[model samples]
Target chain A: MKLLLIITGACLILSFIGDRRKTALGLKKGAMMFLKILPTILTVIIVVSILLYLVPEQKIAGWFGEESGFDGYMAAALVGSISLIQGFIAFPMAGVLVQSGVSYPVIAIFITTLLMVGIMTMPVEARYFGWRMALIRNSLAFVFALVVGVFMGFLWNLF
Target chain B: MRFIKKHGVNIGIIVAFSLFAGYSVYTDYLPGLEILKGNFRTFITELISMLPLMFILIGLFDVWLPKEKVQKHIGAGSGIKGSLLVALLAFMQAGPLYAAFPVAYTLWKKGCSRFNIFIYLGAFSTLKIPMLMFEIGFLGVKFSLLRIVLTMPAVIAIAFIMDRYYAKKSFEIKSLQ
Candidate 1:
């Protein structure tokens, strides 16, 4: 947040000094864009909150552990792909799972899919980037997450 | 009426939330209300903190940065340097994945190569520095480092595949612009 503030402050200062007209225009454009996307933003936030509420974390963790094997990775990836938990909450929770003996690869897949594929944010993504790009990108991310998970498992074993 | 029509989805969601809240109240289910309130509060706080700066940055890019310059650097045939620059920029960003969408749209409209845009989005999702730090803190150095190393190549490959696939289709960039 401080970084954002610092950057924004710097940009504002620079814009004011460099070109006052552009500064005004930028602010206006920014506000306009904000308004334009406000509905989508609201929908996404509400949907994510509801999803997090419904899907109990313990249940999600229960679906993936060291002994769960290939099925466990797939389940983790599926859950991660759909859920929209924030990184702050997710990382700490994942950390606890790791300590509790969940396979690192499963955790990795969970994190990868959680970040890369956003089923909940699909509407927002499609709104911006089109349905084709949104769908293709997400599908590819899902595949990559699986591949990466397997590789991470091998790497973990090697070391 | 036009505004309502345009925001129909959002309104629908709001109505759903209200009905849920009403039902919770009727049933004396206090926990549901508590969850709703807490979730809403968190969402609003996140929005307040992130959206303004993101929109402002997008505006600044739109108003200040010349399309030609952006195109020259990251457009088709921009090579490895363009990819690296975008990857670095994505890594520096500190926000949720959705926050990257507007900026990516602006870049796409400005004629950034499809490959680089995908790379940018991929990097934004998983390679954020702050996120990496958090991962390291929780998952340890080896785990975080391995994921980072592995993800870079995976992201690039996905970008290439996406660019190739989309190029064949009449994927018009003009509609959004």
Candidate 2:
């Protein structure tokens, strides 16, 4: 967060030096963009919150734990796809799962899909990139996330 | 009226959720309300933390970086260099996936190649420096490294496929524009 502030501060300073009018225009454009997307953002947040409320985290961990097998991978992917936790929170939660005997492959799939696919952000993505691009990118990411999970598992077992 | 027409669905969804929350509270379903409030707070904080900076940077990019300059680096014939540059920029970023959209839109308008733009978004979604560090700390070096190694190729391949598919159908590009 501090990093963002620093960067914004620097940009504002630089903008003043370079062109004050442009700087003002930049701020206006930024605010406008924010307003334009506010609705979609709010909707996504509500949906995510509802999902979080409904899904039991403990049940999820159990389904993805050791001996869960292929079902575990699917479960992890599904849960990861739906949830919108930040990476900071996600990695630690995943770490706990790892220590608690959730297989690496499942964890890998969970993390990969969580970061890459973003079911929750599809509306925002579609708004910008069009539904075709957004859908294609996400579908491909989902398939590749599975491949990465399998490969990570293979590599882990080998060594 | 036009704004209402355009945002009617979103506004409706918001209203529905608000009513649901109100009902939940009236029924004394405190847990659901608590969860909703907590999630809302986190969502707002995330937005407050990142959106301003992202938009400001995008605004600055729009103001300062001319189309010609953007095109020279990442447009039609930019090839490998363009991909590399975008990937680097994306890797350096620290924010949620939603924050990347406006920047991507700006890049697209600035004439960045669709392929490199995919690479940029791909890298932004995963492989960010802070995210990687967190992964390494929790998941260990081997797991983190393996995911990174595999992800890069996947990102590139997806970019290639999407670029080709979009090229074949200019309608997609036109729609986005």
lDDT of 1 by residue, A18-137 (tens): 999998998899888678667666666666566657766565456676567789999889999999877755775576566445789999999999999999999888888778888999
> What C-alpha lDDT does candidate 2 achieve relative to the native structure?
0.74
Deviation in angstroms for A91 in model 2?
0.9
What is the TM-score of each predicted model, taking all chains together? Answer: 0.60, 0.60
Q: List pairs with backbone clashes in candidate 2.
A: none
Docking class of 2: acceptable
DockQ computed for model 2 against the true two-chain complex using alpha carbons: 0.39
For candidate 1, the per-residue lDDT at A133 reads: 81
User: Which prediction has the highest lDDT against the true structure?
Assistant: 1
Residue B13, candidate 1: C-alpha displacement in angstroms: 24
Q: Is the docking of candidate 1 incorrect, acceptable, medium or high quality?
A: acceptable
